[model samples]
Structure formats: structure tokens, C-alpha cells
Target: MRTVGNDLVRSQLHENRKWYLGLGALLVVFGIVLLAALPFATLTVIYIFGALMMLGGIIHFIAAFKIFEGGYRWFWALFGVLYLIAGYYAFSTPVKTAIVLTNILAIILIIAGVIRIFNALLFRAFQGWGWTLFSGILTLVTGVIILMSPDAPFWVLGLFLAVDILFQGVNYLTLASYIRREVPKSSAEQ
Candidate 1:
């Protein structure tokens, strides 16, 4: 039997269904646009990263003098200089930076995949272990493919981001539709 609280909850959901659907549609559109212009998106990310690194270096430099002393001050200053040099290199040669970043990501993923797989094995007695194993294998495969491909670094990040956004949008749309379908109807309406 449906309770008054259930009906109220359903009504609330019904009221917000349009907002969910609208946001989902907007995200879907944005994801598609980003996917279409992937190279530009990739470069945009690189440039943004470069800018952030530069900003971080400046902050470190300021902190060194203002917040540190002796060896600590020298350490922060050195760190800041390294950051600035790295940031400048990134900005000056984005393609090389992307390649380096992509390789690092691939290596990390591979290591994580291996670790997850082992963890899943060690915890095989637990529920959901199979899912963990599956995820590990999938992650491993993705990393291997990216590492092996000659040009994967150039576009993998952009493609992954586009797909992630697309899936999130789909999830929102599904939730909105589910809410609409689940709303309780009055006896007369039923």
C-alpha cells in the first residue's frame, strides 16, 4: 500500500523532472561537442595545466620567503624553480608535455590495475570480488592499449573525458525518466 510520504516524495520528484532532463540534455550536447573537437579540447587541457603549474610555482616562491627559513626556505625555492621550469617547458612544447603526461598516466593505470587484481584475488572470499577483478582487467587492458599505441597520448585523455561526460549525462536522463515513471498516481487516475 502506498503511504502519504511516498506520494509526497513522488510529487516532489515529478516537480523536478524537467530540471533533471534539461541538465542531462545540456551535458549530452556539451559532451558531443567536446568529442567532435577533441584535439582542441586536448590542447586546451594542456594549456590549462601549464598555467596552473606556473601559478603553483609562483605560490611556492612566495611561500618560501614568507613562510620558511634556512634549509626549508632553500627547499621551497628549489621546488618553485623546478615547477616554473616544468611549466615553461609544458607551455613551450605542449605536444611533448602531453606525451609525457599520457605515458605517466598509462604507467600509473597499469600499476593500479595490477594492484587491484592482486587485491581482488586476496579478497576473493568477499562478495563483489568478481566485479573488482573485472574492473582490474579492464583497466589493465586500457592501459596496455594506450601504452602500445603510437598516438594514443595525443587523444586518449580527451576521448576518455568526452565519454565520461556522455555517460554522466545518460545517467541523469535515465534518473529523470525513472522518476517520472515511478511517480505514484491517484486511485482515480489509476
Candidate 2:
């Protein structure tokens, strides 16, 4: 009976540990992908933002035609006007949008790095803490560099984006690997 109980407890503990490790690995993979896609992502985001804005504007203009029908028509009209204005603003000052986007990216990187570091700290009592710590530090440093160079030109920002994406990709891949390796076979199988 004692042996059986011990075995059950050990199995449960192993499964829990594996689950946590798997989560960590997933986070690493996510980070890596984010870093790798950072370069092209900026342009993609800008294009998408512009496209959405334009689409929204067009929709609003179309909806404005129905305003005469009443039933919250004024609200729709107001929204339509705002959407049109926003779309034009985005189109007319793409550079400004780019700048703001860059800043946002930098902040996101920093925040992600900080979160990774915190995760590492939380798991300091556990084995394999070093990986989390290293990833966290790397992310934090990269984020800081980007933030410090806020005035970087569009090309520079593009470079940063690429680097960020690469790093994030690496992080994610590493994390995934760790999870695969560390996760309990039983837990994973389940």
C-alpha cells in the first residue's frame, strides 16, 4: 500500500512538473516567432491598419446613407464620420504612424522580456531555470536597445523589426524544445 501510494504521488508530481515545463517551452517558442517576424511585421501592420481604416471609412460612408431611416442613425453617422477622418489621417501621415508603431513595438518587446525575467525568477527554485533567465535577459536587452533608439529611421526600424522577430523565433523554438524534453511523457501523452 505504501509503495503504491508513493508511486501515485510521484507520478502526479512528475505530471505537474511536465505541464509547467511545457508551458514554459511554449512561451519560448512564441517569443522566438515574435522576434523573427518583427521585421516584416511592421509594414504588414501598417498596411493592415491602413486597409482596415479605409474599409471602415467606406462602410461608414455607406451607412451614412441609412441615417435618414432613424433608429440610432445619428450614432452610425457619427461613427462613419470618425472612421473616414481616421482613415484619411492614417493615409496622409504614414510616417507618423510608422514612428508610433515602432515605439509600440519597442515597448512590447521590453514588456515581454520583463515577463520572461519574472517567470524565470518565479521558477528559480526549480531545475532548468537558466534557460528562462537567459532568454529573459536577452529579450530585455534587445528591448532596451530598441527603446533607446526611438528616433531610428524607417529603415532602422525595419532592421530592428527583423532582429526582434528573429530573436522571438529563437526564443519560441527553444521554449518548445525545452517543453518537449522536460514534460512528463505521461502528461504529454495525455
Candidate 3:
């Protein structure tokens, strides 16, 4: 028998199934587009990134003034200003922005990979820790390769991003399905 709390959780998941499915469909569409435009992905990605940055900059700028209190309020404003400038520059020179963003992505991946490896090491007490370590190593290697040749095969980045997005979408859909299946059962039991 399931508890009331379990029924609530299941019901919530069931109610939100449509949202998950919608998100999954959206991501799958994006992945299809990326695959279809594999050849033009390099230039296309530049513009996409530029647009995203500009949009993010606008959001950041708006957020800057919303801080009611804090010593770092101005600091956020300064960063916001920088974001605006960078966004404008990106929109103006998308190719340049692409290269820079790729390099930045590489560096970030490297850092994240190192952190993951360390975390995996600390998780030695847990089972299947080796898988985490292996993934970390793979991530680290990929970062290093990207850092070495950020400009080479730029389209691959788009392809990979698309694939990653699609996978995330599928995961959401699967979770939603599981919730839908289990929720009704739990409620019925209750």
C-alpha cells in the first residue's frame, strides 16, 4: 500500500507529464534540425550562440537593477554591462564569437571534468564509482581535444550539442512516462 504522500508525488508527476513530453518533443525537433543542417551547422551555430548571448545579456541587464540590497549589486551591474557589450559584439561578429565561445566551452569542460574526477574519487565508498571515474576521464580527454583544436570541425560541436539535447529530451519523456504509469497506479491503490 502506498502512503498519501506517495500518492501526492505520483499525482503531481502524472499532472506534469504533458510538460515533460512537450519539452522532449521540442528538443527532438531541435536535434532533427541540427542533423539536417549538419553542413551549415558551423555558421548557423555562430548566429544561434550570438542570439542566445544577446537574449541572456538583456535578461542579465534587467536583473542587475532588481537587486534590492547587497554590496555586490554594482558588481552584478558591471557584469551585466559587460554581458551587453559581449552580446552586441557577438551579434556583430558571430564567427569571432563562435571561436571564442568554443574556446571558453573547452576550458569550462576541462575544469568540470577535473572536478568530476575528484568527486568520483571521493565517491569510492559507493558502488559503481568506477563508471563515474571513467566518464570523468572521457570528459577530460574530450575537453583537452577541443582545447587543442577549437576551430577544427566546428560543425561537430553543433552535432554533438544537438545529440546531447535530444538525449535530455528523451530522458524527460521517459521520466514522464514512468510517472504517468506509476501515478495512476498509486492513486488507485490509495
Candidate 4:
């Protein structure tokens, strides 16, 4: 049983250290570039989203044919058409789509914040519960600010995407370094 937490995984990561390093470097570069060109990155994200929606629509259309149930087939077909329409709309009016998506994100964040706060409060005895409560409050405030801001939609998603990618890149780099350091020690011990 070579679980990810074990030495086998560490050995594999050591073996693939170069790949992780390269990917981390690439993502870090991309994140920095996106952060530099925030507006362009925002539009790029919308375009990518539109393309994904179009792909999803096509998949749904194919699925409709594969589904033998009449109601399911019709439902898939209907949703496929809707997805295609939405994709087209996104492509034609990306800025509007971004704004709409950002607004939705705000709503989702608010909901998540409330849920986190409720969980933290309900599980007061849990270790680090106060941190969870603090995080929830911050999330709630952020969501409120984003929702209220007229200019938030123009850059919020792009900023979030850039930051997420940047962090992921750093995480990859850290994992690679850790594996590189520890694997040699483990090998020597064995």
C-alpha cells in the first residue's frame, strides 16, 4: 500500500523532481505575467471559460445521443443548446460575462463565509476554531466588498486566478525541494 504520505511517494516525487520544478517555474512566470497585465488576463480567462462552455455543450449533445431514455435525451439536448447559446454570448460579450461571473462568485463567497462561521460557532470546542471564525469574517467582508464594488468584476477573478496559480507554483516548488532533500536521506538510511 504505497499511499501518498509514504516513502514510495517521496521516491516517486524525487524521480520526477525536474518535472515539478519545470511546471512550478512555468506557472510562477505565468502568474507574474498575468498579475502584470491584469486586464488582458481577465479577458483571457473569459475567453477560456467560453471555450470550455462550448466544449461542454458539445459533450452534452453527444451524451444526449448516447442516452436511450427519451426524457433524459431531450433534457440533455435542451441543456446542450442552452450551453451553446451561453458560450456564444460569453464570447460575444466577454466583459459582461466576467461581470456576471464575478457577481456570482461574490454570492458564493458570502454563502461559504456564512457556512464557515456557522460551523466554527457550532464546533466551538474544536482546536483552532477561532481561526476558522476569523477566516469566515474576512471572507464575509471580502464578499460584501466585492459585491458592492462597481469595478470589482473587471479585475477580481483575474486577480484571484493569478494569485491561485502563483501559490500553486510555489507549492510545487516547495514539494520538489522537500522531496529532493529527504529522498537522499531515506536512500542513505536504507
Best model number under TM-score: 4
Candidate 1's residue-wise lDDT over 1-190, tens digit each? Answer: 5666676666677778899999899889878987998876677778878898898899999999999999999999998998898889889998998889888889988998999899899999999999999989988888998899988767877787778888889988998999878666633334
What are the per-residue Cα lDDT tens digits for candidate 3 across 1-190? 4577777777677767899999988888877887787646666776666677667776766776775357566676777777777768877876676677777778778888898899899999999888888888888888888888745446556766778877988888888877766556555545
Q: lDDT of model 3 at residue 140?
A: 88
Top lDDT prediction, candidate number: 4
lDDT of 3 at 171: 89
TM-scores of the models, in the given order? 0.75, 0.47, 0.63, 0.86
lDDT of 2 by residue, 7-94 (tens): 5655665546545555556655654554465545555556667778778877876776754557566677777777767667667776
Candidate lDDT values, in order: 0.85, 0.66, 0.75, 0.86
**Alpha-carbon shift of residue 85 in model 3 (angstroms):** 0.8
lDDT (Cα, 0-100) at 48 in candidate 4? 86
lDDT of 2: 0.66
Where model 1 places Cα greater than 4 Å from the true spot, the runs are 1-26, 164-190
Number of clashes in every candidate structure?
0, 22, 0, 0
Superposition TM-score, candidate 4 onto the true structure: 0.86
